[model samples]
Target: MIYAQILAGGKGTRMGNVPMPKQFLALADKPILIHTIEKFCLEPRFDAILVVCPADWLSHTQDLITKYVTDSRVKVVAGGSERNATLMKGIRYLQETFGRHADDVVVTHDAVRPFVTQRIISENIDAVLQHPAVDTVVPAIDTIVQGEADAISAIPVRSSMYQGQTPQSFNVKALVDAYATLTDEQKASLSDSCKICLLAGQPVTMVRGENLNFKITTPYDLRVASALIEKRA
Candidate 1:
């Protein structure tokens, strides 16, 4: 089975007290999450679309799905406080509802990143067919620096650095086992899913990501997303 686990657990605090979470914000005529969901729905490869939303917004998420999504495969569930927790909840639900397979693919994505292309999603699915895990990444176009307090600590090799993007796919059993190995401390520090695979000593394949596949974190990103949609239209 192939799953698209959309994580929308954030409070949207970075968006400065918006009435709604950033994922629910309208990009044009549709909610940001609807756009994201539509991308996965169009692929025809996903067996089910699972959305993990903040507990308080679970009903609201359902309403959005009812209004915009015609695919009955979409399912909504309450998400946990952190990214990893949210993902764990999602995977557990998948296992309970549909059963897990060693070769099953789960493509976890951010609900706010609506610009993820079908190409990237397909690439991840294809890559994971050979490797147990796969992550999408774009080559860094700028000089990256590691800094502390007031000083630059180190300058990483520009050629080697790649910015990670989502639709990070993994074999169901592989990911579940990786998360099972995480200590409490490591679990609390979790941010990226690919890190879990790496910490478990599993090899992850990298697929090329597009420049437009950026997460909508701040208000500026929302505006840029709007402009991109307009340009596309």
Candidate 2:
């Protein structure tokens, strides 16, 4: 079974004046997270969806899901402190509630990336199935610069660098086992789920990604997302 795990536990501190978490804020006529969940729900490839939200926002997320997504396969679960924690929570919940094995595919995604298209989701699923040793990633388009503050230096590269985006698909068992081995310091410093896999000496591959899959983090991002949605509409 293919499960879509949406991580929505952020506090939205980067959004400054935005009253609520960026994922809970509305874009187009619905909440950003609702739009994200709806995308996967409409896709036939996804057998189920698990939304991970802040512990305090669990009820609110449930109410929103009830109102927007009618899919019986969707569920809401409380999230943990960090992104990895939230993702692990969703993974465990899916295992317990759905009785899915570690071999099942879990598509981990950010809730604020409302514009993730069905095509991207499908491609990720296919890539994971074919390349179990490599986690798929989309190629980066912009030039990459590396270094400290004012002395920031540009690293010249012949090959294009790919920026990582999610719905990063993984074998459920591999992911679960990876998390289980994480050291306390590693767990404390890690941010995204893919990072955990990376630190575990796992190889992440590249998959082509769309520009629309950009995550909403700031007020300006909301404005940009609004414009993109309007254009698509």
Candidate 3:
């Protein structure tokens, strides 16, 4: 089975007073979460699509899905305080609702990243068939620096670094097992799911992602996404 889990748990603290979370913000003619959901619906290969939203937004998210999304495969669930925990919610839901399978693949994405393409989704689904985990990335065009609050510590080789993006697909059982190995402290520090796999000593294969597939976090990113949408329109 192939599942698409949309992580919409974030509070969008960096987006200032947006009235709603970043995922609920309007991008073009639809909400960002709806835009993200459409991409998965476009593929049709996903056996189930799970939208993981904040506990407070559970009904609101379901309303959005009902209003804009016609696909019957999608369902909504309340997310946890953190991204990893939210992901586990979707995974566990999949297990409870559909039962776990060794060959099942779960493609988890950030709902605020509305620009993810059909090709990226399809590629992740395809790549996960060969490798246990697959992550979408784009090469860093600028030189990356490691820094402290007051100083630039070191510069990493540009060729060796890539910015990780999502629709990070993995074998469902493997991902669940990786999370099982984490301590509470380690779980709190997790910023990305690929890191969890790496921490568990699993290899993550990379797929080149489009530059437009950026997450809408701050006002600057919101403006950029709006401009991109207007330009596309």
lDDT per residue as tens, model 2, 109-155 = 89998888888888878877665423435565666778887787777
User: Please, what are the lDDT tens digits per residue for candidate 1 over residues 1-233?
Assistant: 88889999988889886899999999999999999999989888888899999999999999999998999999999998888889989999999999868788899899988999889988888888788899899999999999999899999999999999998998989988988998888877777998898988899889999998999999999899999999989
**Candidate 1 wrongly placed segments (more than 4 Å):** none
**Stretches > 4 Å off in candidate 2:** 100-102, 133-136, 153-160
Q: Global lDDT for candidate 3?
A: 0.92
In order of appearance, the predictions have TM-scores of 0.97, 0.92, 0.97
Clashing pairs in 1: none
What is the C-alpha lDDT profile of model 3 across 1-233, one tens digit per residue?
A: 99999999999999998788889988878899999999899988899999999999999999999999999999999998788889988899999999878999999999999999989999999999888899999999999999999799999999999998998999988888888998888887898998889988999999879998999999999889999989988
Cα error, candidate 3, residue 227 (Å): 1.7
Candidate 2 lDDT: 0.82
